[model samples]
Target: MSLATLWALGSVGDRLRVAYRLLSKDLDMQIETTAVIRNVQKGTASGDLTTHGLEFDQLDPAQQMAMKAFVFDRQDDALEWSHGAR
Candidate 1:
């Protein structure tokens, strides 16, 4: 997410709809979901930017399963890597 996304989302505990586009060599899909802003931290990102953690809510069962599968597929990577585009 960008700085604008952070600003538009407001503070922690806020609920927001996020649009996600997943693309790869053979796959493309878009998902829209609501997420709860779980945490925000200053100095956790580059320069003066802040980082936020979101907990997804009201997910379609397939969406949730796909996300879990994606993360599991990359289980060897750093935990933060899977946060992208979701």
Candidate 2:
């Protein structure tokens, strides 16, 4: 998703912990990841995520965008963890 989408979703003030599945177009592989909102600034929202046992920033750009788009689009109705349970 775009920065505009993140803003519309009120990401600046809300802590959104998200999980998403991403399929690599080239590798034909699927990855599941989890991210926790860290901060938002200058029209950009950023967070820490672990995918395939690697930090989000360590992943390729395509993987990063895929995760961001997936989470941003679903944050509104997304479920949250409650006392360690969803």
Number of the top-ranking candidate, with TM-score as the measure: 1
Each candidate structure's TM-score, on Cα atoms with residue i matched to residue i, is 0.63, 0.28
Q: Taking the tens digit of each residue's C-alpha lDDT, what string does model 2 give over 1-86? A: 12223233334334333334443332333444433333444333364322121133244577666666656545532543233344
Whole-structure CA lDDT of model 2: 0.40
Q: Residue 38 lDDT in model 1? A: 81
Model 1: residues with Cα > 4 Å off, grouped in runs: 1-8, 23-27, 44-46, 76-86
- Write the residue-wise lDDT of candidate 1 on 1-86 in tens digits: 33233333567889878888654433356779888888776664545556678878787877776666655655634455766534
- Regions of candidate 2 where Cα sits further than 4 Å from its true position: 1-20, 23-29, 32-57, 79-86
| Model 2 CA lDDT for position 46 | 68
In candidate 1, how many Å is residue 10 off?
Answer: 1.7
Please give the lDDT score at residue 37 for candidate 1.
81
Worst 10 residues of 1 by lDDT: 1-10
